[model samples]
Each structure stands twice: as structure tokens, then as C-alpha cells.
Target: MHIVIIGVGGVGGYFGGKISNSNQKVTLIARGKHLEAIQKKGLQVKSINGDFITHPFLATDRIDIVEKADLVLICTKSWQVPEAAELVKPILKEDTIVIPLQNGADNAEKVSTVLGVKHVLGGLCRIYSKIEAPGVISHFGHQPDVVFGELDKSKTNRLQKVKEVFDQAGFNNSISGDIEVDIWSKFMFITTVSGLGALTRVTIGEMYENKGTRHVLEQTATEIYKVGIAKGVSLPEDIVDRIMTFIGKQPYESTASMQRDIMEGRPSELDNFNGFIVKEGIKAEVLTPVNTFIHSCLQPMEAKARI
Candidate 1:
């Protein structure tokens, strides 16, 4: 399959590198110094699992150079989705599956509005990764899983084809029957974790070690889960227990990419994560005090980064 990965940051770089290493025709859409680094030295992934490099894949800043791909993985920060969708339009064909591997439940809807509903796929990635340098991506854990499916919950040949590509690349993947529910479940986990970590300036390990902070984290998760339920999403009753268990097994120093972005003075996906919860909570008539508080607290940091 001809694949184009838009925004070759942590998520894009890691996955794209893996696919490229497996001999897939992958084109990376990147810009600035990172683009230069990839062009000169190839893409590098420094992971705990192992480090590898892919030097032969195409890398370009121009969307016009990107062919009509079988799959387009939109991996930009949440704020860049609309503009990225506009940029990707000319390079898309009718059957091209555009997977929005971004945080927040609104990405698929937003991309569908621009790229047409049939062409968009809802996806979430689980990985602790970052662009450690201009041409380098650092993956700290073993959580490299990609979950995606059709927006309408139908099993199609295209879905299976995409899964085949991922499987060939030796990556973990799953096709969900209810993509919206999957997106919400991931959003619930990410927003709560990012908000709490950013607010406290602590890693997942530090938060888990402190009973007070852990309580706050649980309360935050409950608030977000309630908002999801109020919006008519039937999240599992044991979601808190599941999330806690999952988090406990993670390395204590593990942090969300959003928290890392905030700490690095880079723009975050706050609007999509906590900000989305606040917007949806208002519409669903759900009181999300914890979400609201964290969203407000992070607003200044995001604003300052822009200036």
C-alpha cells in the first residue's frame, strides 16, 4: 500500500519508520529541520525495544509530491487537523482511508467533514514516544498499538487491507466494531492523564506514588467518564479499574505527549483533550469541574507558547 504520514512527529515518525523498515511504500510529509534531517540521514527510532533507521523512504514537505495513497495517516497535533485536511485533499482518492491518529474524539468528525465521511477512519495509538531531536524519535515503552476502524462500524475490505499492512509491519493492531466508542475510551484515558500530569508537573510514576495525587487522578477520570456517559457513550462500568491497572503497570516516569509538549514550550492538544471535554460537557449538561479547572490552568501555558 502507498501510505503518506502527515506530520512526522513522535507518532508519525515511529509508525512510519516501522512500516518503511518493513519495505512498505511510505512517504512522510514533514517540514523544517526535521525534514532536512530525514532527507540527509534518514528517519531514526531510538526505542527500548531496539533502534533502527530507514533511509530509502520518500520524505517531502509538498503535498503535491505525495501520491494518492491507499492510506493517509494524519498524525499532526490536534490543532493542525483542519489545515492538514485541506492540504491533503488534492492528494486523496475516493478509496483512500484517511486515519486520524490524533487525540480527542472530534478529529474523525472534523476530518470527515473535510475529506468526506467514506474516506475517513477513526484511530487511536498507544505509545510513549516523542521527537527527541530533529531527525530522531524516542520510544520509551513497549506500548506500540494502533486501533482503528470505519466510522460507521461496518467491516469493509479496505479495513482489512489496512490491518494487513500493519500486521505485515509486525505491529499490534485491532479493528473495532464501534470506532466512536473506541475513540471516547482513549480520550477518557488521555485527557485525565495529561491534565493531571501537566497540572502537577509530575510523571505517571510520581502521581501513582502519592495517594492524594492518585485520588485526584481517579476523580478526574470519573469526571471525564461521566461526561462521556452523559453524551450517550456507554463506557464500561469498570473503566476506572481498568485504567488504574493499565497505568500502574506503566513506568512511573512515563508521561503523556501533551505534558511533554507543555514542558517543552511546544503547543499542546489541550483544546482537543480537556477543552473538548469542557465543550461536550456543556452540551451534555454534565458538570466537569475537574476538567474545567485543568483546562483553565493550561490555557496560559498554551497561550504563552504561541507568543
Candidate 2:
């Protein structure tokens, strides 16, 4: 199967490299120095599980140069999903499967709006990785896990095929029975810490170390839980507690990509993360004061980066 990975950052590079190494036909879409590096050498994955490098079947910035793909993995930042979908549309066959492994809750919806529901799948990934340098992915923590499924929950041959491919590539992946809940479940955990992490400018460990900050983090998570529940997502009542325990168990030095982006003065998923919760809360009549506060605090810097 020919696979095209849109946005070869941490998520795309690591996963794509693994797939390509398994002798699958994989094409990577990246730009600038990272693209140059991959073209000259190869995509490198420095992973805790194992480190390996594989040259993809193709790596190019221009989507037009890619082959018509059987699957398109949309791994771009949340804000870039729509435009990236449009760019990759030209290379898609009607039966092509497009799965978005992004952080935001509404990524599939965003991609579906551009590529249509027939070609889109609801998906989320659990991994802590980022670009250590051009064309190099550093997977520091968490055994990579991917969850994906059809929007309508029908068990199609394509879903089974994709799962088989993931299995063949030695990935811990699942086809979710309810993709929406899975997406929101991951969203609840990520949104709970991401904005607060940015605002505090600390690692997850440091944030929890301060009792006061930990309290804020708990509240932030609770607000997101409320929003998820209000949106009719099947969120368990103990989600916040469960996530808190999970957070405490993670590497204390671990930080969300959004936090690092904000710290480095790059545009982040501020609007997509905390800002999303705030908007959903308003629509759902759920109170999200903590999220609003975090979003408001981070707005100026986010806007400045865009300017």
C-alpha cells in the first residue's frame, strides 16, 4: 500500500519511519531544512523503544509529486489540518483513508469538512515525541499508541487493513469502538495540562510539585471533564483522578508540545486546546472559568507569534 504522511514532525516522522522501515511504501511531506536533511540523509527516529533510520519511498514538500495514496496520515498541528487537507486532496483516490493523529478534539471534523466524510477517520495518538533537529525525531516517553476508527463505527475492510498494517509495523494501535469518546478522552487529558503547562512555563513534574499549581491543574482538568460530559461524550466521573495519577506517573521533565512552542515563541495550539474548551463550554452551557483564564493569559503571546 502506498502511504502519504502529511507533516513529518514528531508524530509523522516517528510513525512514518517505523512504517517505512517495515518495507511499506511510505511518502513523507515536510518542508525547509527538515526536508533538506531527509533528502540528503534519511528520516531518523531516536526512540526509547529502539532507534532506527529509514529512507521513505519519497519525501517532498510538494504534495503533487506524491503517488496516489491508499492511506494519508494527517499528522500536522491542529491549526494546519484544513489547509493541509486541501493540499493533499489532489493525490487522494476516492477510496483513500485519511486519519488525523492530532491533539485537538475536532481534528477529524476539520479534516472531514475539507476532504469529506467518506475519506476521513476519527483518530488520536498517545506519544511524547518531537523534532530534536532537522529530519530527526526524538521519542522520549510513553510507548506510542494509536487509536482510530470509522466515523460511523462500521467495521469496514479499510479499517481492518489499516489495523493490520499498524500491527505489522510493531505499533500498539487499536480500532476504537467509539472513536468520538476516545478522541475526547485523549483530549481531556491533554487539554487539562497543556495550557497550564504553557502558562507556568514548567515541566509536568514541576507543575505538580507546587501544591498551588497542582490545584490549578486539577481544576483545569475538571473543567474539561465537564465540557466533555456536557457535549455528550462518555467520560467517566473518575477521569480527572485517573488522569492525575497518570500525570504523576509520567516523566516529570515531560512537557507538552504546546508549552514548548509557546516558550520558544512559536505559534501553538492555544486556540485549539484551551480556547476550544472555552468555546465548547459556552455552547454547551458548561462553565469553563479555569480554561478561560488560561486561554486569556496565553492569547497575547499566541497572537504576537501569528503577527
Candidate 3:
């Protein structure tokens, strides 16, 4: 099968690199120094499972030439999903399967708005990684996992086909029984930590260890949980507690990708994370004080970064 990976950041790079090792053909769409480096040399992945280098059949910024993609992974930030779908639209075959593995609960919906529901799938990835250099990706923690399925939560031939490719690539993957819940579970955790991390400008450990910030953290998660429940996501009542415990177990130095992006003054998923929850809260008639505060605080930075 021919696979295309858009936005070869940490998630796309690590997964694409591993998948490229198999017999299937892989093409990576990237831009700037990263694309140049990948074309000049190859993608170097430093992973906890193992380190390896992979040369995709083609590595370029042009998606037009990557025709007949059997599968496409949109790994861009949540806000960029629509743009990605629009750009890759012409290259998609009727049977092409596209998965948005970016953070955010509505990524699949965003893609469907552009490419239609039939072409999109609900997807999310679990990994801690980043670009260490122009063409180098560092997977510092977590066994990478990709959870995906049809948007309506039904099993189909196409789902199994995608699973076979993931299996062949040798990374952990799951065809989610409840894809929406899976996406929301990840959404709640990432937004809670990322918003707090960016707001306080501290590591996860520092944020949680401080009494005042810890209270805000708990409030943030609780607000997000309330919003999720109001929005009718299948979140368990104990989700906030479990998420807090999960955050507590993270390494002191651990930080979220969104947090890193905001700290480095790059455009991030601010609108898609806390901002998304705030918007949904209003629509659901739910009160989200903590999330509103985080979104309001980051607006200045987010606006400046986008410029």
C-alpha cells in the first residue's frame, strides 16, 4: 500500500519512519529545513524501542505528486486539519483513507468538513517525541500507540486493512471500540496539562508540586470534565481523578507538545485545546471557569505567535 504522511513532525516522523521500514511505499510531505534535510539525507529516528534511519520512497513538500495514496495521516496541529484536507483532496482516490492523528477531539470532524465523512476516520496518537534536529526525531518516552477507527464506530474492511499496515510496521495500535471516547480521553488529559504548563511556564512536576498551581490544575481538569459531560462525550465520572494520577506519574521534566510550542513562541493548538473546550462549554451551557481563564491568558501569546 502507498501511504502519505502530512506534516512530518514528531508524530508523523516517528510513525512514518517505522512504517517505511516495511514493504509498503511511504511518502512524506514536509516543508522548510525539515523537508530539505529529509530530502538531502534521510529521517533519523532516535526511539526508546530502538533507533533507525528510514528513507521514504519520496520525501518532498509537494502533495500533488503523491497521487493514489491508499492511506494518509494528517499529523499537523489541530488548527491545520482543514487546510491539510483541502490541500490533499486532489490526491485522494475514492477509496483513500485519511486519519487525522493530531490532538483534539474534533479533528476528524474538521477533516470531514473538507473531505467529507466517508474519507475521514477518528484517530489519535500516544507518544512523547519531538524534532531534535532538522531531520532527526527523538522519541524520549512512552511506547507509541495509534488508536483509530471509522467515525461511526463500526468495524469494516477498510479498518482491518489499516490495522494490517500498522501491524506490519511493528508499532502498537488499537482499533478503538469507542473511538470518540478514546479521542476525548486524550483530549482531556493533554488540554489539562498543556494549558497549565503554558500558563505557568513550568514543567509538569513544578506545576503539580506547588499548592496554588495544583489547585488550579485540579480545577482545570474538573472544568474540562464538566464541559465534556455537558457536551455528552462518553467520559467516566472518575476521568478527572484518573487523569490527575496519570499526570502525577509523568517524569518531572515531561512537558506537552502544545506547551513546548507555546513556550517556544510557535503557533500551537491553543485554539483546539483549552479554547476548544471553552467554546464547547458555552454551546453546551456549561460553566468552565478554569478553562476560560487559561484560554483568556494565552490569547495574547497565541495571537502574537500566529502573526
RMSD of each: 1.2, 1.0, 1.1
What C-alpha lDDT do the candidate models reach, one value each?
Answer: 0.88, 0.91, 0.90
**Model 3 RMSD, rounded to 1 decimal:** 1.1
TM-score of 2: 0.98
For 229-278, candidate 2 gives per-residue lDDT tens digits of: 88888888898898888878878899999999999999999999999999
lDDT of 1 at 147: 97
Q: After superposition, how far is residue 305 of candidate 3 from its true place, in Å?
A: 1.1
Worst 10 residues of 2 by lDDT: 184-193
Q: How much is 124 displaced in model 2, in angstroms?
A: 0.8
Order of the predicted models by lDDT, top scorer first: 2, 3, 1
